[model samples]
Target: MSLFFKNYKPNTSIYNRQVLWRCNSTTATQNTEDEEEFRVLDILKKRDRQQKRVVRRIEVQPDRTTKMKPDQNWGNVWPGPRSFHPASVPLPLRQGYVPKGQAPPGKYANAELMKIPNFLHLTPPVIKTQCEAIKKFCTEWPKLLNSEEAIEKHYPVEIITSDYCHGSPSIRNPLARIVTLRIKLSSLNLDQHARDKFLRIVGDRYNETTDLVTLTADRCPVRKQNLDYVNYLLTASYHEAWTYEDWETEKTEQDMEYYNWDNNASKRSLVDWYLKVNNDDRSLTEEEYKAFDISVIPHGVEYKDAVYSLMNDGESDATIKNYATAVRKLLGLPVKVDRDV
Candidate 1:
């Protein structure tokens, strides 16, 4: 080693640089090999941890409907209205809009079945059970009100409403909220003026033939509100009909709906003419004519009926003939005349 050292005449700068380079390369290579070994060990440790792990298993509960017997009382099971559930119902209900040829989808997870209202709660058995449960709360019908006429007479106002059931998402119907009230006009016990006013106020709502007045109110959103509104309308109209307006007293003969010989100018004219004929130039003055009673005359009743029938019923052949006959008889002429005059 001494002889080799002596023989090695070192190139000081170049030799030192080469030694430094080799040492750095060796240190880098060692560091790389250590990193690779740690990485491989970490991978093996992860694999070992995964293999040692245990997966948990959970027990599942079965559907309640699966245990239900076929003969079980359905009224008890479905007591009232509720949303549709697939697992709870046993029947194979199929529904859904699909292509024309393809069959309808099954009830399982079907949106169509869930969307619409169902009548499961209103089955015959359920209805009967419900009726029996509430039977004790209801009162017995009165024996006197046996017939429709009797019932109508006792209960004058009849309010009507409707309920609907259809294949719809919502059970509520717009038309069902509408209310109708019906009552006979005579039931109100109105006087002549009040009756005429009431008829006018009701207009087309009053049925002249049947003497029934119908009131309908549907502006409200609910049935109760509509019913109350209709009742209010009927009450208001009845009260208003009784209230006499100043303008109504001024209604003239031309404005009259029907002819009445008792209050008409024709009665005064007929009385004056009859008096003049009987007493020779002794005729009725305006004041005496106003106070005159047509019944004191012989042909007053016959003349009144004929004139009323003529004017009230229009100029028909029968009315004209009756009027002519009454006029001739009142003046002591033959009723059946040969000439046109």
Candidate 2:
């Protein structure tokens, strides 16, 4: 029957309807069952692959030299005989992948593949359980303390108000747990009493001082002195929050003032430069004359030495003193000159 069906072809001939019907029904049923079984097996294979991902192991050797043998692989993925050498081959029940210096794609997908074993084998079997508890606590507490939400959940009451403390967006209130968790997270030399002092400093900046606790229901204390409060206000303000426009205005004003001074000095120096150039006194140009600011620049700047010596001119002692005072006012300093006492 199989050979006849293999040789059969659907030519344009009307015959054998019953045989064709039986062949089609049997073939469809076999194909459907085969596909279903293949799918089930495929799912089971995937599950097996996932189960082998994070296999951990430890090793023991009788002597240090026996541990150094190179032929034995560390992990289960490599194939070899169960040869009993004294070398440090893995024991029956050490728990993460001891990759043979090379990891597979499927095994590497497990995030815990690189982590240490879930168990430990001790030389003295008595201490193994205690060591495990210590390891578990040391590993897990840090992961909790590193997160702010965990700290707040565990330690709700803070010694200080949480306002003055600031940190990254992920760490909303790091100050609240800064000291409580600091002992676990950081290695500062601070004892519990010192931590209390630090928390007080942080809280007091936000008007959370001891005095604020004494507020009455009916009456509020009116501020007697604005000076201290205003100073506090200024100190509390963040100085670097100036706008771009403010900086631009300041820079522009500075540039204009610098150029004005440069122009004025150039004009004053030109009066001397021209005298040296021409060897004759001549009227100055309109630009040079305009550059000299009369309100700001003094006439004595051109003849400051002559003005100083003229102080000892024959006049009353009060007049001479007034001249000395005027010179000091103009030069922005008192000049020491020899005069009869």
Index of the highest-TM-score prediction: 1
TM-score of 1: 0.62
Candidate 2 matches the true fold with a TM-score of 0.14
**Residue 146 Cα positional deviation in candidate 1, in Å, after optimal superposition:** 1.0
Candidate 2, 288-329: lDDT as tens digits:
565544444453453333333343244666556656765565
Q: Output the number of the lDDT-best candidate.
A: 1
How close is every model to the real structure, measured as TM-score?
A: 0.62, 0.14
Local accuracy by lDDT, each model = 0.84, 0.42
The residue ranges of model 1 lying beyond 4 angstroms of the native Cα positions read: 1-43, 51-70, 164-173, 250-252, 265-341
Give the runs in model 2 whose Cα sits over 4 Å from its true position. 1-110, 113-256, 288-341
Residue pairs in clash, model 2: 55-96, 56-94, 56-95, 56-96
Cα misplacement distance, residue 328 of candidate 2 (Å): 25
Q: Could you tell me the lDDT of residue 139 within candidate 2?
A: 43
